[model samples]
Target: MTASSSAQTPGKKDALAGREDAYNGFLIDLEGLPSSPEALLASLRASEAVWRERAYRGIWLRLPKRLAGSTGAAVEAGFEFHHAEKEYLMLTRWMVEGQPDALPPNASHQVGIGACVVNEHGKILAVRELYGPLRGTGVWKLPTGLVHVGEDITETAEREVLEETGVRARFAGVLGVRQAHNVAFGKSDMFFLVALTPEPGQTELRPQLEELEGACWMDPAELTEQPHFVKRPLFQSMLRACRDWAEGRPAALHQRKITSDDEQRRDLILLRSTGGEDGEL
Candidate 1:
């Protein structure tokens, strides 16, 4: 008999009955399964017989957030936690007795950065994307982009601001962090908020034709009052923080420096202990 034919058992019916030939194993879709530990344990035990009979390669168990309580029972049945998202968790049980090359790969989170630039006039710099989820939706947001490899997060914010809107800005500090799971393209995304101060003598607004349709400096009051901005929690939170900073309230931002292996220390010259010019730390 062929390998596929040999893997099938006769006169046995379980979760693996119909799908045996397709996936070469059983998949316990625990979406609507009972959340009780006892029920989960029973289900896992019943699948073990089919696993041994078929000599299956692997068994997958998907656990939604609602059934999180069944995790212990799954672990007890030799299932290991694999990956998780905001909605569900994935676990795997290897039926084969030998070692495998590597464990199942988990999803990676993508890091993004947004620049929140506020000029001396207390107006916030915003952009309207030429194409995106909010394209032509009258939704104007802060200039944001993904952090490129080997680039500092703060520097990424500065670059994105300049690219989308022709505005030179000095990095002030971080404002906050935002995270979302299973975002566009089934990937988890993270955003870092970088505050910036506009450089002197640069005030013209020029939007990048490729990504942005319009770019301009918006008054903080007008920004908060916009119907579109009111619906987004991120923008609302940023408006509050900007208002506080404008009122002389100190920003709760921490300063950080980007360093690399090839970074060189600044040169220093010292006269004496009593009268010294400078010395590098």
Candidate 2:
């Protein structure tokens, strides 16, 4: 992957180099001081028009270095970082205080889970699918699902696993946040890797053929053999999480409102969704 010009800074470069060696690995700790809620909220109002109707894919999209510096009021106000690819980054619109909601409009209200399953040998669990969204469907993927309304994300994972494969398990730590852009879906989703362990006597694991065309268990080494696995965001995220867990690392949790700062303010300013347009704002 080509490193972007901005990633050349000493700090960014060092981090990128370390991440490369790890091969798509990095620790993002979102647990820190929160930003000023009101000032941040106000700024979102003033900048709403600028961020609308733009699909910017990099850090430069947030604000040029000319108008803003490496450190700005935005960063101090709880800036969030989204890793689109190895070198690309996107800053989230809200501070830590009001999160999970800070996501973009298209990205809002999304929740998915990944099982950090491990076997008797202490190796993390993974599955190779003979069918599904992947190219040949012979790809490794973490058993995951979308959280339904009122259902918890964790519960969705467990229920999906049982419904799709019939395995009961528990989760421990978070793997990492995965970002993927799908033209087909016309949206982006963040997948959370969760550490999970099957309950005792729950060893009989197999994909319900009716639900899934085919599925099988695989470890790190075996996972690499099947190239198709890398194509899936969930699988790729799971693999990265497994490797991180193997090395005792934690996935970064950068929570941002799915809505752009401006949209959020617009929502607040207008305070309601009108069925009809108001000509132009």
Candidate 3:
């Protein structure tokens, strides 16, 4: 296998050369390399020495799918698997000692919420987006948006529905959870399925023209017949679950009781006795 290197300081031949984009260290791109464990071991050992001598912060070794066989070598050499996709596997090793055992505290997963709003007539609220990855695909989906800081998941669902369809609904409970890797801009995403019902007076549909082409209530039969919707079995399943919930079926509780700072400490003690600590009954 052949290996090539790039650095912030072009003329410098040191592998551990400092660089602004290297997270205070260097990066080794190992794409399109042959799957040879021996060659990978040799490269990793050499890189480790350079990192120690230069006192770099960290090093990232990116291995494409073709070189996936070399992953064992990387791990043995103290590189942790950061993330992976169908195209590549990313691994990183910190040169500094005493790093935390877990991922950096700042590492986070993107949280999103999808509102499954159904009316008393057994019709579900759906919207067509004016622009997105699935725009013009004729796919109608529930209103969804990212969860902002200090915002609850249920509140996010309600806000997204109001902003996209101009319909205010009450949160019922959680329907399900969906996790996808490398979904949005290479970040892992967690989507909560929140159930909602129309409030006493809010039944009118007013689509947000900037993001939605149209908003309407669709019957279950129509949803099943739609070609695009039929292609997505998960949407069909969620619709059925939401409909059941609207018809008085029970759902998992997603809401929690609010408590004062002093009460919060006591609540933690109670939770420990109720199997919350070990996640058992």
Best by TM-score: 3
Tell how far residue 238 is off in model 2, in angstroms.
4.5
Off by over 4 Å in 1: 1-107, 258-281
Candidate 3 lDDT by residue in tens digits, 24-127 = 55666444233687777766675566667666676767788877888898898888987776898878777778875332433357999888888878788888
- Candidate ordering by lDDT (highest first): 1, 3, 2
lDDT of every predicted structure (CA atoms): 0.71, 0.48, 0.70
Angstrom error at residue 70, model 1: 39
Candidate 2 TM-score, C-alpha based = 0.45
Tens digit of per-residue lDDT, candidate 1, span 103-188: 34675778898787888777889888988788889877778898886666767878888888899897765666788899867889
Pairs in steric clash, model 1: none
lDDT of 3: 0.70
Give lDDT: candidate 1, residue 78: 88
TM-score of each: 0.55, 0.45, 0.57
Give the range where candidate 2 is weakest over 10 consecutive residues by summed lDDT: 12-21
How displaced is residue 39 in candidate 1, in Å? 47
How much does candidate 3 score in TM-score?
A: 0.57
Q: Where's the lowest-lDDT run of ten residues in candidate 1?
A: 269-278
Q: How do the residues 196-246 of candidate 2 rate in per-residue lDDT, one tens digit apiece?
A: 667787767677766465445566666644676556675665676676665
CA RMSD (A), model 3 = 12.0
Q: Model 2 off-target regions past 4 Å?
A: 1-109, 128-131, 181-185, 229-238, 246-281
